[model samples]
Target: MAGAADAATTLVGRVLAGRSGALANRLDLAGIRTKPQDFAFLIGVLAVAVLAATLLLGAGWLSVIAAAASPVVAMLFLNIRIARRRDAFATQLDGTLQLLASSLRAGYSTMQALGSVAQQSEEPSASELARIVNEARIGRPVVAALEEAADRMASEDFHWTAQAIAINREVGGSLAETLDGVAHTIRERGQIRRQVKTLSSEGRLSAVILMALPFGVAGFLMIINPAYLAPLFASGLGIAMLAGGAVLMVVGGIWLYKTVEIKF
Candidate 1:
């Protein structure tokens, strides 16, 4: 039995290995330290639990749907975590640039200034800068390291900062001043982003409430009178209607999201 179980685990690991590399990169970006295989196992367990619960509720179709949706839900959660981490890194960019500029003005070389920031700054920022410093120490060009970091974080401000550094290296300019200018621009953009988020808050809230209403109503009905929602899960026509409603709701949610998301 032990050998069989070990063989099953190895089979599962092999099956997941191809996808695990990408998942591991995303988890790293999200600051999650779990091994990809472990994370995959946890998600599989959650999916199985959801499938079992739905089956226990006596809805075969619902169990199938739950099983199918579970992995998607896990991916969505991972994406949200990565996005939040990226946003946090972006939020810290201005301060990080300012500190780098200060370190430079104090006579540190570019790499040394970055190391200083890595030591002095807080979370995400410190770790990211530390990674760049480590890369530079290993003979990777500082500009390339910066560019890679920008790409990883998807931060335009950091990309511009990297550009400025690259240009400064090729030309003759005060690197400190260039960083200070980039910091100022990032600060202004941050302010604008916050204002936009504030203005769109109401619309975002409305979208959430709108998207959740049907599910909320269905759940309430289930609690008050389980039989009321029985036909929806039991009959083919009702199931088709439910699927259609779900697709439409997803489309409407995406439309609402696009409408409120302002690109500047």
Candidate 2:
């Protein structure tokens, strides 16, 4: 049981490590540690496979193959969702900092600017800054409040600003000017990223279609041909090949993804 718990911990630890903002960090603030959802995710993965095979067992060989592959599909979808959300949150980081800088220039104190941002910014950022302001109003130190805010949002861009604020309070410098520079830099970087994404959209789409076409056809074949696809899963060698093929497809997709994703 300890080993199982350890494994689960490791899985969630990886996810949490990959995350920093409102979703994961709030758990720490609320005295909550790791989430049961981590273990649930593992179970969900296994369950997807089991349920698919069971449901399609007597269908066609192609049907069983499709069912067996459902787990991989489900996990891929889950991963895409997580990645998209993380990307969106990261994309918003620069804007959030720009908003903070603008508010500061408008005569708002840091805390007040954050509070106003909480009231106006979109979800996740709004949800997070509101927490920071609330925590400060309850008497948390300004630095701690700001740290908590950074730790919660956890974007590279946002964290840089947070570090500036936290470090500035101790050593002191022109914080607003520093933040203004940072915001401008972020805006420029974001524009370049947007252009890269636009330029790479065709390649990304090709990758998606290339990856999905085979599986989609296999599913359609299973609906039409049962005997033809049966031997592939009934034998161990076939199962290995099936798994290998699936892995190859994933690897290819990842390669295409990286090819198109221009990192700045």
Candidates' C-alpha lDDT: 0.88, 0.71
User: How well is each residue in 164-236 modelled by candidate 1, as lDDT tens digits?
Assistant: 9999999978999998988888888889989999999999999999989988999999999999988977889
Which segments of model 2 are wrong by more than 4 Å? 1-82, 135-154, 170-174
lDDT of 1: 0.88
Model 2 residue 102 CA deviation (Å) reads 4.0
Query: Which stretch of 10 consecutive residues in model 2 shows the poorest summed lDDT?
Result: 23-32
Count of clashes, each model: 0, 1
TM-scores for all candidates: the values are: 0.91, 0.65
Model 1 / residue 79 / CA error / Å: 0.8
Prediction 1 TM-score vs. true: 0.91
Superposed model 1: Cα runs more than 4 Å off: 1-9, 53-61
